[model samples]
Target: MTLNWQCIVVDCDDPRQLAAWWAELLGWRLTHAGDDESVLEPAEGSPQDGVSPDMLFVKVPEGKAAKNRLHMDLRPDDQAAEVARAEALGATRVDLGRPDDASWVTMADPEGNEFCILRAFTPEELATLE
Candidate 1:
C-alpha cells in the first residue's frame, strides 16, 4: 500500500502567533489547542478543502537559530501580491542565493522559518518539467 503525507510540525517559541501568521498567509482555518500547539488546515469548501494535510505548530524551549532543512514552496497566481500580503503578515524577505531572474522569492516567517513564494507555472511549463 502507498502512504500519504500528513502534517508538517514546526517548532516555534509561540505556536499561536506563528500559526496565526500561517493561517493568514494561506487563508486557512486555525485551530489552537490548550497545550500551546496550533494547526492550520484548509477551510471547508475551500480549494484545498479536506484534501491537504494540516500544518502543525508546537511550542519548544529553544528558539530558531538556523535555516530550515525542510521548507515550503508556495505557488500563487499573483506572486507579487502574495509576497506583499505575506510581508504585511510579518514575513520578511530572505536571500537564499537565488538568481535575479528566479521565479521564486524566499521569505521567513516572524519566527524565522523559511518558505518560498513562487510564480504560478503555466500548464506548458509544468508539463515540460515533468
Candidate 2:
C-alpha cells in the first residue's frame, strides 16, 4: 500500500503561540488546544480532510538551532502580494542556498523553522521556469 502524506509537525516550545502564528499565516483555523498542545487545521468547510493534524508544541527545554530536517514550502495564489503579506505576518527571511535568480524566497517562522515561499506558477509558467 502507498502512504499518503499527512501533516508536517513542528516542534516548538510554545505550542499555542506557534500554532496561532501558523494558522494565521496559512489561513487555517485553530481546531483544538490543550494545556501542552495545540492543533491548527484548514478552516471550516475548507477542502482539507477534517482530520486536524497536531502541531505538537510540546514543552521543550532547549532552544532551536540549525536547519530543520523537514520544512514546508508555501505558494500563495498571488506571489508578490503574498510575500509582502507574509512579511507583515512576522516571517523573517533566511538564506538557504537559493540562487539569486531563483523564484522562491526562503523564510523562517517565529520558532526559527525554515520554510520557503515559492512563486505560484501555472503549468505553463512552471514549464517556462524550468
lDDT of 1 by residue, 51-72 (tens): 8889999999999988799999
Clash pairs of candidate 1?
none
Query: In candidate 2, what are the lDDT values of residues 29-119, reduced to their tens digit?
Result: 8777665777777887776647644355554667887888888788777888887887898988888888989988888888888888898
Model 2 poorest 10 in a row by lDDT: 52-61
Give candidate 1 regions above 4 Å deviation.
123-130
Instruction: Assess every candidate by TM-score.
Output: 0.88, 0.82
**Whole-model lDDT for model 2 versus the true structure?**
0.79
Cα error of candidate 2 at position 78, Å:
1.3
In the predicted model 2, the residue pairs found to clash are: none
